[model samples]
Target: MKHVLLALDESDDRAVAQAETVRDLFDTEHTTAHLLHDFTDNFEGASVGQIAAVRHAANILEDAGIAVEYHETSGSPSTSIIEAADELDVDAITIAGRERSKAGKVLFGSVSQEVILGTDRPVLVCSRRTEE
Candidate 1:
Protein backbone atom coordinates (compact mmCIF):
# COMPACT_ATOMS: atom_id res chain seq x y z
CA MET A 1 0.00 0.00 0.00
CA LYS A 2 1.25 3.49 -0.81
CA HIS A 3 1.61 5.98 2.04
CA VAL A 4 0.79 9.65 1.51
CA LEU A 5 1.48 12.53 3.85
CA LEU A 6 -1.36 15.04 3.72
CA ALA A 7 -0.36 18.40 5.13
CA LEU A 8 -3.17 20.59 6.47
CA ASP A 9 -4.08 23.79 8.27
CA GLU A 10 -6.79 23.33 10.86
CA SER A 11 -8.53 26.64 10.30
CA ASP A 12 -8.12 27.56 6.69
CA ASP A 13 -11.00 26.79 4.39
CA ARG A 14 -8.65 26.87 1.45
CA ALA A 15 -6.50 24.25 3.08
CA VAL A 16 -9.51 22.06 3.74
CA ALA A 17 -10.73 22.43 0.20
CA GLN A 18 -7.36 21.55 -1.22
CA ALA A 19 -7.16 18.49 0.97
CA GLU A 20 -10.57 17.36 -0.25
CA THR A 21 -9.42 17.85 -3.79
CA VAL A 22 -6.30 15.83 -3.12
CA ARG A 23 -8.39 13.02 -1.67
CA ASP A 24 -10.67 13.02 -4.68
CA LEU A 25 -7.83 12.98 -7.16
CA PHE A 26 -5.34 10.61 -5.58
CA ASP A 27 -6.73 8.47 -2.79
CA THR A 28 -7.54 4.80 -3.34
CA GLU A 29 -8.96 1.94 -1.33
CA HIS A 30 -5.50 0.70 -0.46
CA THR A 31 -3.82 4.05 0.17
CA THR A 32 -2.79 5.01 3.68
CA ALA A 33 -2.78 8.74 4.49
CA HIS A 34 -1.02 10.51 7.28
CA LEU A 35 -2.88 13.75 8.08
CA LEU A 36 -0.30 16.19 9.40
CA HIS A 37 -0.52 19.67 10.94
CA ASP A 38 2.32 21.91 12.01
CA PHE A 39 2.09 24.60 14.66
CA THR A 40 4.45 27.49 15.24
CA ASP A 41 3.93 27.41 18.97
CA ASN A 42 6.11 25.00 20.90
CA PHE A 43 3.36 23.71 23.08
CA GLU A 44 1.78 20.30 23.55
CA GLY A 45 1.18 18.49 20.33
CA ALA A 46 -2.20 18.19 18.62
CA SER A 47 -4.44 21.07 19.51
CA VAL A 48 -8.20 20.57 19.68
CA GLY A 49 -8.67 22.36 16.37
CA GLN A 50 -5.94 20.30 14.78
CA ILE A 51 -7.54 17.08 15.98
CA ALA A 52 -10.87 18.16 14.63
CA ALA A 53 -9.37 19.08 11.30
CA VAL A 54 -7.49 15.81 11.09
CA ARG A 55 -10.66 13.91 11.92
CA HIS A 56 -12.50 15.89 9.28
CA ALA A 57 -9.93 14.99 6.67
CA ALA A 58 -9.74 11.44 7.97
CA ASN A 59 -13.44 10.95 7.45
CA ILE A 60 -13.11 11.81 3.80
CA LEU A 61 -10.25 9.35 3.27
CA GLU A 62 -11.78 6.63 5.42
CA ASP A 63 -15.05 6.87 3.55
CA ALA A 64 -13.05 6.28 0.39
CA GLY A 65 -11.59 3.12 2.03
CA ILE A 66 -8.19 4.59 2.76
CA ALA A 67 -6.51 4.03 6.12
CA VAL A 68 -5.76 7.24 8.00
CA GLU A 69 -3.33 8.41 10.66
CA TYR A 70 -3.13 11.80 12.40
CA HIS A 71 0.21 13.50 13.04
CA GLU A 72 0.94 16.86 14.67
CA THR A 73 4.15 18.77 15.31
CA SER A 74 5.60 22.14 16.34
CA GLY A 75 8.13 23.71 14.01
CA SER A 76 8.55 25.27 10.59
CA PRO A 77 5.67 23.93 8.52
CA SER A 78 7.73 22.90 5.54
CA THR A 79 10.45 21.33 7.62
CA SER A 80 7.95 19.50 9.78
CA ILE A 81 6.12 18.20 6.74
CA ILE A 82 9.33 16.91 5.19
CA GLU A 83 10.35 15.31 8.47
CA ALA A 84 7.01 13.61 8.83
CA ALA A 85 7.20 12.33 5.29
CA ASP A 86 10.62 10.86 5.94
CA GLU A 87 9.72 9.43 9.35
CA LEU A 88 6.54 7.85 8.10
CA ASP A 89 8.36 6.71 4.97
CA VAL A 90 5.57 8.14 2.88
CA ASP A 91 5.64 7.69 -0.87
CA ALA A 92 4.50 11.23 -1.53
CA ILE A 93 3.65 14.51 0.20
CA THR A 94 0.42 16.36 -0.54
CA ILE A 95 -0.25 19.96 0.40
CA ALA A 96 -2.84 22.65 -0.27
CA GLY A 97 -1.60 25.87 -1.86
CA ARG A 98 -3.56 29.04 -1.40
CA GLU A 99 -3.62 31.84 -3.93
CA ARG A 100 -1.27 34.62 -2.99
CA SER A 101 -0.45 37.90 -4.61
CA LYS A 102 3.09 38.18 -5.85
CA ALA A 103 3.87 40.73 -3.18
CA GLY A 104 2.29 38.59 -0.49
CA LYS A 105 4.19 35.55 -1.66
CA VAL A 106 7.40 37.48 -1.61
CA LEU A 107 6.72 38.88 1.85
CA PHE A 108 5.70 35.58 3.35
CA GLY A 109 7.29 32.43 2.03
CA SER A 110 5.05 29.61 0.87
CA VAL A 111 5.21 26.35 2.79
CA SER A 112 4.21 24.41 -0.29
CA GLN A 113 7.03 25.91 -2.31
CA GLU A 114 9.49 25.19 0.45
CA VAL A 115 8.33 21.61 0.76
CA ILE A 116 8.50 21.08 -2.97
CA LEU A 117 12.05 22.43 -3.07
CA GLY A 118 13.29 20.77 0.12
CA THR A 119 12.12 17.19 -0.33
CA ASP A 120 13.37 14.52 -2.68
CA ARG A 121 10.06 12.64 -2.67
CA PRO A 122 7.17 13.46 -4.91
CA VAL A 123 5.05 16.45 -3.89
CA LEU A 124 1.47 16.93 -4.92
CA VAL A 125 0.27 20.52 -4.50
CA CYS A 126 -3.43 21.10 -4.95
CA SER A 127 -4.52 24.66 -5.63
CA ARG A 128 -7.43 26.03 -3.68
CA ARG A 129 -10.42 26.15 -5.97
CA THR A 130 -12.41 29.33 -5.89
CA GLU A 131 -16.12 29.21 -5.23
CA GLU A 132 -18.50 30.29 -7.94
Candidate 2:
Protein backbone atom coordinates (compact mmCIF):
# COMPACT_ATOMS: atom_id res chain seq x y z
CA MET A 1 0.00 0.00 0.00
CA LYS A 2 1.15 3.50 -0.72
CA HIS A 3 1.83 5.54 2.41
CA VAL A 4 1.23 9.26 2.24
CA LEU A 5 2.07 11.84 4.87
CA LEU A 6 -0.36 14.71 4.92
CA ALA A 7 1.26 17.77 6.49
CA LEU A 8 -1.46 19.90 8.03
CA ASP A 9 -1.83 22.92 10.23
CA GLU A 10 -4.92 22.19 12.31
CA SER A 11 -5.90 25.80 12.72
CA ASP A 12 -6.08 26.52 9.03
CA ASP A 13 -9.30 26.10 7.09
CA ARG A 14 -7.24 25.47 3.98
CA ALA A 15 -5.99 22.29 5.54
CA VAL A 16 -9.55 21.00 5.74
CA ALA A 17 -10.07 21.65 2.07
CA GLN A 18 -6.77 19.94 1.26
CA ALA A 19 -7.84 16.91 3.28
CA GLU A 20 -10.89 16.50 1.08
CA THR A 21 -8.75 16.75 -2.01
CA VAL A 22 -6.31 14.16 -0.71
CA ARG A 23 -9.16 11.79 0.13
CA ASP A 24 -10.54 12.06 -3.38
CA LEU A 25 -7.20 11.61 -5.08
CA PHE A 26 -5.87 8.56 -3.32
CA ASP A 27 -7.42 5.15 -3.37
CA THR A 28 -8.70 4.41 0.11
CA GLU A 29 -8.55 0.66 -0.36
CA HIS A 30 -4.93 0.76 -1.38
CA THR A 31 -3.49 3.72 0.42
CA THR A 32 -2.66 4.66 3.97
CA ALA A 33 -2.92 8.28 5.04
CA HIS A 34 -0.76 9.65 7.79
CA LEU A 35 -1.90 12.93 9.29
CA LEU A 36 0.96 14.99 10.64
CA HIS A 37 1.13 18.18 12.64
CA ASP A 38 4.25 20.01 13.75
CA PHE A 39 3.65 21.85 16.97
CA THR A 40 6.18 24.55 17.63
CA ASP A 41 5.09 25.48 21.12
CA ASN A 42 3.14 24.14 24.06
CA PHE A 43 -0.52 24.89 24.13
CA GLU A 44 -2.68 24.51 27.24
CA GLY A 45 -4.01 20.97 27.75
CA ALA A 46 -1.76 19.64 25.00
CA SER A 47 0.69 16.88 25.61
CA VAL A 48 3.97 17.12 23.77
CA GLY A 49 3.53 15.93 20.19
CA GLN A 50 -0.26 15.75 20.40
CA ILE A 51 -2.12 17.09 17.36
CA ALA A 52 -4.98 19.53 17.86
CA ALA A 53 -6.18 19.48 14.27
CA VAL A 54 -6.67 15.85 13.33
CA ARG A 55 -10.31 14.93 13.87
CA HIS A 56 -11.84 16.67 10.88
CA ALA A 57 -9.19 15.37 8.52
CA ALA A 58 -9.21 11.95 10.16
CA ASN A 59 -12.97 11.73 9.78
CA ILE A 60 -12.79 12.29 6.07
CA LEU A 61 -10.25 9.52 5.56
CA GLU A 62 -11.92 7.09 7.95
CA ASP A 63 -15.30 7.53 6.29
CA ALA A 64 -13.66 6.70 2.99
CA GLY A 65 -12.35 3.48 4.52
CA ILE A 66 -8.76 4.57 4.28
CA ALA A 67 -6.35 3.51 6.98
CA VAL A 68 -5.24 6.54 8.97
CA GLU A 69 -2.48 7.30 11.44
CA TYR A 70 -1.56 10.46 13.35
CA HIS A 71 1.85 11.85 14.13
CA GLU A 72 2.54 14.98 16.09
CA THR A 73 5.89 16.37 17.05
CA SER A 74 7.37 19.64 18.20
CA GLY A 75 10.01 21.34 16.10
CA SER A 76 10.49 23.48 13.03
CA PRO A 77 7.46 22.62 10.94
CA SER A 78 9.33 21.77 7.76
CA THR A 79 12.04 19.85 9.54
CA SER A 80 9.52 17.87 11.55
CA ILE A 81 7.62 16.90 8.45
CA ILE A 82 10.80 15.82 6.67
CA GLU A 83 11.84 13.73 9.64
CA ALA A 84 8.43 12.12 9.86
CA ALA A 85 8.42 11.26 6.20
CA ASP A 86 11.86 9.78 6.44
CA GLU A 87 11.05 7.81 9.56
CA LEU A 88 7.78 6.53 8.16
CA ASP A 89 9.30 5.90 4.73
CA VAL A 90 6.24 7.43 3.18
CA ASP A 91 5.83 7.34 -0.57
CA ALA A 92 4.87 10.97 -0.72
CA ILE A 93 4.31 14.06 1.39
CA THR A 94 1.27 16.21 0.79
CA ILE A 95 0.85 19.77 2.06
CA ALA A 96 -1.52 22.69 1.69
CA GLY A 97 0.09 25.84 0.38
CA ARG A 98 -1.14 29.39 0.54
CA GLU A 99 0.02 32.28 -1.55
CA ARG A 100 2.40 34.63 0.13
CA SER A 101 3.95 37.83 -1.07
CA LYS A 102 7.60 37.79 -2.07
CA ALA A 103 8.37 39.92 0.95
CA GLY A 104 6.48 37.57 3.22
CA LYS A 105 8.27 34.55 1.82
CA VAL A 106 11.61 36.23 2.15
CA LEU A 107 10.97 37.18 5.75
CA PHE A 108 9.23 33.98 6.76
CA GLY A 109 10.47 30.95 4.95
CA SER A 110 7.67 28.61 3.92
CA VAL A 111 7.43 25.17 5.49
CA SER A 112 6.27 23.59 2.25
CA GLN A 113 9.13 25.17 0.42
CA GLU A 114 11.61 23.95 2.96
CA VAL A 115 10.27 20.42 2.87
CA ILE A 116 10.46 20.35 -0.88
CA LEU A 117 14.01 21.63 -0.85
CA GLY A 118 15.28 19.45 1.99
CA THR A 119 13.89 16.12 0.87
CA ASP A 120 14.20 14.08 -2.28
CA ARG A 121 10.82 12.44 -1.76
CA PRO A 122 7.99 13.58 -3.98
CA VAL A 123 6.02 16.43 -2.48
CA LEU A 124 2.45 17.10 -3.45
CA VAL A 125 1.32 20.64 -2.76
CA CYS A 126 -2.41 21.39 -2.70
CA SER A 127 -2.88 25.10 -3.00
CA ARG A 128 -5.97 27.14 -2.23
CA ARG A 129 -6.36 30.08 -4.57
CA THR A 130 -7.72 33.18 -2.98
CA GLU A 131 -10.18 35.44 -4.73
CA GLU A 132 -9.08 39.04 -4.95
Candidate 3:
Protein backbone atom coordinates (compact mmCIF):
# COMPACT_ATOMS: atom_id res chain seq x y z
CA MET A 1 0.00 0.00 0.00
CA LYS A 2 1.16 3.51 -0.79
CA HIS A 3 1.48 5.82 2.21
CA VAL A 4 1.20 9.61 2.03
CA LEU A 5 1.57 12.18 4.76
CA LEU A 6 -0.91 15.02 4.27
CA ALA A 7 0.06 18.09 6.25
CA LEU A 8 -2.95 20.38 6.69
CA ASP A 9 -3.34 23.87 8.05
CA GLU A 10 -6.60 25.50 9.19
CA SER A 11 -7.94 26.41 5.78
CA ASP A 12 -10.73 24.17 4.62
CA ASP A 13 -10.24 25.04 0.97
CA ARG A 14 -6.60 24.16 1.09
CA ALA A 15 -7.48 20.94 2.86
CA VAL A 16 -9.88 20.06 0.07
CA ALA A 17 -7.21 20.70 -2.52
CA GLN A 18 -4.68 18.54 -0.74
CA ALA A 19 -7.14 15.70 -0.25
CA GLU A 20 -8.25 15.84 -3.88
CA THR A 21 -4.68 15.80 -5.05
CA VAL A 22 -3.97 12.68 -3.03
CA ARG A 23 -7.11 10.98 -4.26
CA ASP A 24 -6.31 11.87 -7.84
CA LEU A 25 -2.64 10.99 -7.81
CA PHE A 26 -2.77 7.69 -5.99
CA ASP A 27 -4.84 4.57 -6.04
CA THR A 28 -7.40 5.24 -3.33
CA GLU A 29 -8.05 1.59 -2.66
CA HIS A 30 -4.40 0.96 -2.01
CA THR A 31 -3.38 4.32 -0.60
CA THR A 32 -3.22 5.17 3.09
CA ALA A 33 -3.08 8.82 4.09
CA HIS A 34 -1.53 9.92 7.36
CA LEU A 35 -3.27 13.21 8.19
CA LEU A 36 -1.06 15.52 10.22
CA HIS A 37 -1.85 18.84 11.86
CA ASP A 38 0.63 20.97 13.78
CA PHE A 39 -0.90 22.94 16.61
CA THR A 40 1.06 26.08 17.25
CA ASP A 41 0.70 28.32 20.30
CA ASN A 42 -2.58 29.66 18.99
CA PHE A 43 -3.87 26.13 18.81
CA GLU A 44 -2.16 24.81 21.87
CA GLY A 45 -3.68 21.60 23.31
CA ALA A 46 -5.92 21.14 20.29
CA SER A 47 -6.50 17.67 18.97
CA VAL A 48 -5.96 16.83 15.34
CA GLY A 49 -9.58 15.77 14.99
CA GLN A 50 -10.76 19.09 16.44
CA ILE A 51 -9.43 21.01 13.46
CA ALA A 52 -11.90 21.67 10.66
CA ALA A 53 -9.25 21.36 7.99
CA VAL A 54 -8.32 17.93 9.24
CA ARG A 55 -11.96 16.83 9.34
CA HIS A 56 -12.56 18.07 5.83
CA ALA A 57 -9.53 16.35 4.44
CA ALA A 58 -10.35 13.17 6.29
CA ASN A 59 -13.86 13.11 4.90
CA ILE A 60 -12.64 13.61 1.37
CA LEU A 61 -10.07 10.87 1.56
CA GLU A 62 -12.32 8.45 3.38
CA ASP A 63 -15.08 9.05 0.86
CA ALA A 64 -12.61 8.24 -1.87
CA GLY A 65 -12.03 4.86 -0.18
CA ILE A 66 -8.56 5.72 1.04
CA ALA A 67 -7.53 4.60 4.50
CA VAL A 68 -6.55 7.44 6.83
CA GLU A 69 -4.82 7.93 10.20
CA TYR A 70 -4.75 11.17 12.18
CA HIS A 71 -1.63 12.60 13.78
CA GLU A 72 -1.10 15.70 15.89
CA THR A 73 1.95 17.54 17.18
CA SER A 74 2.72 20.90 18.73
CA GLY A 75 5.75 22.74 17.43
CA SER A 76 7.17 24.44 14.34
CA PRO A 77 4.88 23.46 11.50
CA SER A 78 7.57 22.78 8.94
CA THR A 79 9.75 20.94 11.39
CA SER A 80 6.89 18.88 12.76
CA ILE A 81 5.67 17.96 9.31
CA ILE A 82 9.13 16.91 8.18
CA GLU A 83 9.66 14.87 11.29
CA ALA A 84 6.29 13.15 10.94
CA ALA A 85 7.06 12.26 7.35
CA ASP A 86 10.35 10.77 8.38
CA GLU A 87 8.89 8.81 11.28
CA LEU A 88 5.99 7.56 9.20
CA ASP A 89 8.24 6.77 6.25
CA VAL A 90 5.55 7.82 3.86
CA ASP A 91 5.96 7.57 0.12
CA ALA A 92 5.33 11.29 -0.24
CA ILE A 93 4.43 14.40 1.75
CA THR A 94 1.58 16.62 0.58
CA ILE A 95 1.09 20.20 1.70
CA ALA A 96 -1.09 23.09 0.62
CA GLY A 97 0.53 26.30 -0.56
CA ARG A 98 -0.92 29.70 0.21
CA GLU A 99 -0.61 32.79 -1.93
CA ARG A 100 1.94 35.17 -0.54
CA SER A 101 3.92 38.09 -1.81
CA LYS A 102 7.65 37.69 -2.29
CA ALA A 103 8.26 40.20 0.44
CA GLY A 104 5.93 38.35 2.76
CA LYS A 105 7.64 35.08 2.01
CA VAL A 106 11.04 36.59 2.63
CA LEU A 107 9.92 38.16 5.86
CA PHE A 108 7.81 35.35 7.34
CA GLY A 109 9.17 32.33 5.54
CA SER A 110 7.00 29.61 4.01
CA VAL A 111 6.25 26.28 5.63
CA SER A 112 5.70 24.56 2.30
CA GLN A 113 8.99 25.84 1.00
CA GLU A 114 10.76 24.75 4.17
CA VAL A 115 9.27 21.26 3.96
CA ILE A 116 10.26 21.04 0.30
CA LEU A 117 13.85 21.91 1.09
CA GLY A 118 14.23 20.01 4.36
CA THR A 119 13.04 16.56 3.41
CA ASP A 120 14.60 13.94 1.18
CA ARG A 121 11.25 12.33 0.36
CA PRO A 122 9.02 13.49 -2.47
CA VAL A 123 6.81 16.46 -1.62
CA LEU A 124 3.57 17.37 -3.35
CA VAL A 125 2.50 20.98 -3.07
CA CYS A 126 -1.18 21.75 -3.69
CA SER A 127 -2.69 25.18 -4.11
CA ARG A 128 -6.33 26.00 -3.35
CA ARG A 129 -8.50 26.36 -6.42
CA THR A 130 -9.13 29.95 -7.35
CA GLU A 131 -12.54 31.02 -8.46
CA GLU A 132 -12.45 32.34 -11.99
* Tens-digit lDDT string for candidate 2 (17-132): 66777778888899898888777876665742355457777777888888888787888999999999999999999887665697764432377779989999998877654569
Candidate 1 TM-score, C-alpha based: 0.79
Candidate 1 vs candidate 3, TM-score winner: 3
Order of candidate numbers by lDDT, starting with the best: 3, 2, 1
Clashes of each: 0, 0, 0
Show model 3 residue runs off by greater than 4 Å. Answer: 42-44, 101-109
Using TM-score, give the best candidate's number: 3
lDDT of 3 by residue, 61-116 (tens): 99999999999888899999999999999999998777679766553237878999
lDDT of each: 0.76, 0.78, 0.90
Which prediction has the highest lDDT against the true structure?
3
Candidate 1 C-alpha lDDT tens digits along 102-121: 77665334787789889999
lDDT of 2 at 103: 71
Q: Is candidate 1 or candidate 2 better by TM-score?
A: 2
Candidate 2 CA-lDDT value: 0.78
For candidate 3, give the lDDT of residue 125.
82
Which residue pairs show backbone clashes in model 1?
none
